[model samples]
Target chain A: MKTATFLNRDEFLNHWQGHRKLTRRTIEKFPEEEFFTFSIGGMRTFGELVKELLTISVPGLEGIVNKDDKPFSHDIELADKAAALKMWDEQTEQINELYNKISDEELYETFNLFGQYKDQTNNNLMYFHDNEIHHRAQGFVYLRALGIEPPFFWER
Target chain B: MKTATFLNRDEFLNHWQGHRKLTRRTIEKFPEEEFFTFSIGGMRTFGELVKELLTISVPGLEGIVNKDDKPFSHDIELADKAAALKMWDEQTEQINELYNKISDEELYETFNLFGQYKDQTNNNLMYFHDNEIHHRAQGFVYLRALGIEPPFFWER
Candidate 1:
């Protein structure tokens, strides 16, 4: 029996990119000092969360494309919001390039991600979206608490 | 020209239900008192957030299915965690029922959600997923802050 396909490769790319656009705006909304330092209820700062996203997207896609099982790392750092946005823009491009390298057929193939999580390529890809949205939502709450209005969620 | 389909109806339903399952687990992990009263940085309690979810899912879908453009409401209240879970389970079933009433072709039809937000049925459906994941992520932060280990996200 043939497995059902959810999103065609292009659809997935467009959808993921839309989410990235919104998340990028979310990152920009933060003040430099607060972006890295603010937290509510002992949650990590939004910058730390953003760092995890930056670490995941391009690196995770590259791992899938290169068949590398490197350990997960959030070791990268940025000097300020400007540096972080620059890296985000760069990885947005890299994600597109690396994502296209994997054919539609490959989406179903199982692969180990970050030498720890193993799942089909499609699930791993979905996880990328899930992880980013999870952190971005936290950023939303942070913005609200800080008395800043976040960009509309449906804009993406 | 034919528009590209992202997810088939069943695929969308299954993906959505998976999110619902994980969200239910997140609700389950909260202590009854904290679920309603505990919040950080002026964020609403997880219980309030869950009430919003409860309000949106069934009523929103009912709007879609019946072509009823009702105003958005988060007025529904539950007495305890048990009551919330019971409502969630009932809505889970209602979502399945109401979702099936929309054929694959109708997924492209535009509807004004809660008589305010208007978009294609497909996008509105996606918003359901997006909204849940967004709040659930907040719930995750709440859980961590309360020294609770929330369920693994990937389980869904």
Candidate 2:
């Protein structure tokens, strides 16, 4: 397989961090009541969606770095938007700490991420970022459905 | 700034191509009438959102490789979703060809993408992927609202 041009690790992390900041703001924009209860067309509530993101990201990266073979779990327990926001903050730090442990060579090594989705380490890392954007976009739609303005997509 | 471990060029392109495939499937899942007309809480219709994705991606990438300083234009002329999908196929080819023109060194070079976002070429490229996922999430919400099932998020 031909190696393609790629962003250096810090650049990738910076890009991920930018999206994370935007997602955090999206969570902040949700109304307290709707955050946990709102749903569109039988989709999960915004809070549940956030829980999925929270579960996948930090633990996912930790698994990648540690070579841990845990199956993916959506088991985060949070009572309110505040607790979720706090967890988001903690994950932000965890990402910074764990991300540095990965070396450039390791990025090309294949890892069975979350005990599934075997791919190059870099691809798995991108999944963490991609998954957040996927769910956050749902939160964006939810905000609109509730007649609230979402923070600008470019604000991050 | 420290360089972080990152995907090789081919890996990044492959990752992007996978997401594009899923997004195309998302577009196909939309009901034609709803594709152009449906919205929740005044968000842009799914067709319009797809339009934004189509407009930004290939043109933005073209600018990056050519060193063109064109400001962003949402001026893509498409009569409907079918036309949009045809253009998407063309752009998919365009991405494969143009992507290779961007050497690894070019990924780190800063360019004024869309004449607005001034960042490393790689980050700008990421903005393309991130923006597509964001809008496609909106399409997912629209599909649910119309009682249609979207393509699975991980299917890409």
- Give per-model CA RMSD: 2.8, 1.6
What is candidate 2's lDDT per residue for B13-115, written digit by digit as tens? 8888999999899988888877778999998888888888888888888998899978877766778779988998998999999988887788888998878
Candidate 1 residues lying further than 4 Å off, grouped into runs, are: A1-7, B1-8
User: Could you give candidate 1's per-residue lDDT for residues A1-156 as a string of tens digits?
Assistant: 112333456767877899999999998998788988998767789999999999988989889999999987897868889999999999888988898888766677889899988878877787788788888998988887788888888787
When summed lDDT is taken over every stretch of 10 residues in candidate 1 chain B, the lowest stretch is B1-10
DockQ of each: 0.37, 0.73
lDDT for B106 in candidate 1 is 63
Which candidate achieves the best DockQ against the true structure?
Answer: 2
Prediction 2 global C-alpha lDDT: 0.86
Candidate 1's TM-score on the B chain:
0.95
Q: What value does the lDDT take at residue A58 in candidate 1?
A: 90
- Pairs in steric clash, model 2: A4-B9, A4-B10, A5-B9, A9-B4, A9-B5, A10-B4
Candidate 1: C-alpha RMSD to true structure equals: 2.8
Could you give candidate 2's per-residue lDDT for residues A1-156 as a string of tens digits? 656547777877878898899999999999999988999999999999899988888888789889997987787789999999999999899999898887778788888887877888887788788888989999998998889999999887
